[model samples]
Target: MSQFSTPLATTPGIMLVRVGQAGCALRWDAQAACWRWPDPQGGQLYAWPAQDSMPSGVRLLESAGLIACCRSGRVLLGLGKRLGSVELPAAGQSGRPLQAQVLATIDAAEARTVISDGRTDRQGNFVFGTANTGADQRPIGSFYQYSTRHGLRRLALPVVVAARSIAFSVDGARMYFADATRGDIMQCAYDAERAKVSDVRTFASVPAPAPERGAAVVDGAGMLWSVQGGALARYDADGHPRQRIELVREPVASMAFGGPDLRQLLLLGARGGLYGLPAGVAEELAPGVADTPFDDGPAAVVDSQRPHHGD
Candidate 1:
């Protein structure tokens, strides 16, 4: 068994949006509830512990604070607060339940990885991407820029490309995302203040394609950190490789800086659970808060009443 298995006994307070293993959990529901899993036969209501098998097998997760796309076409937002048993609509034509609306829809086939770019400016502009499955699957999807007034718009890249892990500069001036299909980190300059984009370039490339959905972080030292299979890779401000350290196992797709000083490196591994490692220089991250469009709440706590793998 993996080291991650034992820690489950002591629950962490923060809620996370977990995917792969069980199923995708969403927070868009009332008080941040989740669907057990999607029905294989296309049934409306899924059982609590969805019997269907998922691709990633419960590894990828995000800090439960915003909305994300799940494996089965479900959009989830974390409540942050613990509310008793909550209920959600069986997947269907039923309109999404939330104050924020979906300005654009990147065909279900293209979108598997999604991130909230915090929020738009006074003009209401935002950026989002879909994961690149592969050429046999989907060549390269589009990175979209949406606005309440103009509606679904595309951020023209030199070519049509799909990006997995995405982040915005602290000022939200430029957008950074990874091409998991090609193993290169990329950036696009955005005059988010004016809702414009220009100057697209490859930031960095890895030795291997990042698995399903890779995770990345821009540290205070102005370095880029991304996860390959089982290692934490670092890049300079210009995207030059700095260093990489191998962790225990192949990671699914989640990373965060925790510990009292926010220095401890946290990893979410595929099939295993959460793992922690140490890095030399402790760094603080300048959070990209303004990029997010909606403020759901503090983030909902995990609902224990729901069924899953034995606790």
Candidate 2:
């Protein structure tokens, strides 16, 4: 009883690659021509050459967390409640392990909280969220932003059980955040210059029976590509549900857009594997949309509503 027209494993457009034990925080490091991600539960960071299937791994500071490539060629890592940076070893330094330098740390107080998801904004600032890691997984996690100019600051969103899937609109005027516990994706007006987010409202609500949401990315046409369980869903700028791409049986931990034109959709499977869909699939899903735009515009506020995903 799936909405997809064809079985995911049988689709010619999709390709799969095994990468790790549980791949998350997938990102494209354009400057280095490589893809980066972390095995949050495995305490490992990984980098794969853009054109090769082999991946290099490094021990991380935290037992598990997320990672984002920074503008300085180093990677920003969100481990537990601390944010740090690490430089990937040079080509010939494969024998040496990379190390993380802690830049900022957050005291979770008595609760056992850890960083869950992270991404870099258009302005080169790193934004990430934290979640309670206790047995009950309480709704005490919060969102934060970090930059060299302003340091680290928390956002004004209500505490949630867990936060995942952080993304920005094509023009960077809107920011999308997903609360995995509530199965809701929220959008807010983002001001990159001032590094502020406001007018938080629900954008889409995933239907019941779906797994908790995972990582997400925005396409050139302003559509949000979000992963949940073993499928990827597309939502238009207004939060209208569009197409859905069925992936492997395992949950998709994260994803990134890469390739020379940035149309290749790279998926990180929770089982520590990498998968991809040809650029043509992305072009078909987001036709006429251009890459991230620099022009700034006023943020739009829309009433929260659940997008209709037909049965």
For this target, which candidate reaches the highest TM-score against the unseen true structure?
2
User: How many steric clashes does model 1 contain?
Assistant: 20
Candidate 1 residue-wise lDDT at 206: 47
Q: Give the per-residue lDDT of model 2 (tens digit) for 208-271.
A: 6646787888887788888766567777777776776665456666777776677677777777
Off by over 4 Å in 2: 1-13, 278-283, 287-311
Model 1 spans > 4 angstroms off: 1-103, 108-126, 132-135, 147-150, 158-161, 207-213, 258-264, 279-311
Supply the TM-score for candidate 1.
0.53
Question: Candidate 1's residue-wise lDDT over 1-311, tens digit each?
Answer: 32122232221212223333321211112122222222111212222222143212121122222343332243333222111112344434353322322333344333433332222332334445444444454445555554334444556653324455565665556667765546467877776544467787777754443443355666556666666554556666887765654534444344544333344445444432344443223333332121133322333422222211111
Please provide TM-scores, in order, for all candidate models, with all chains considered together.
Answer: 0.53, 0.83
In TM-score terms, candidate 2 sits at 0.83
Q: What would you estimate as the lDDT of candidate 1?
A: 0.41
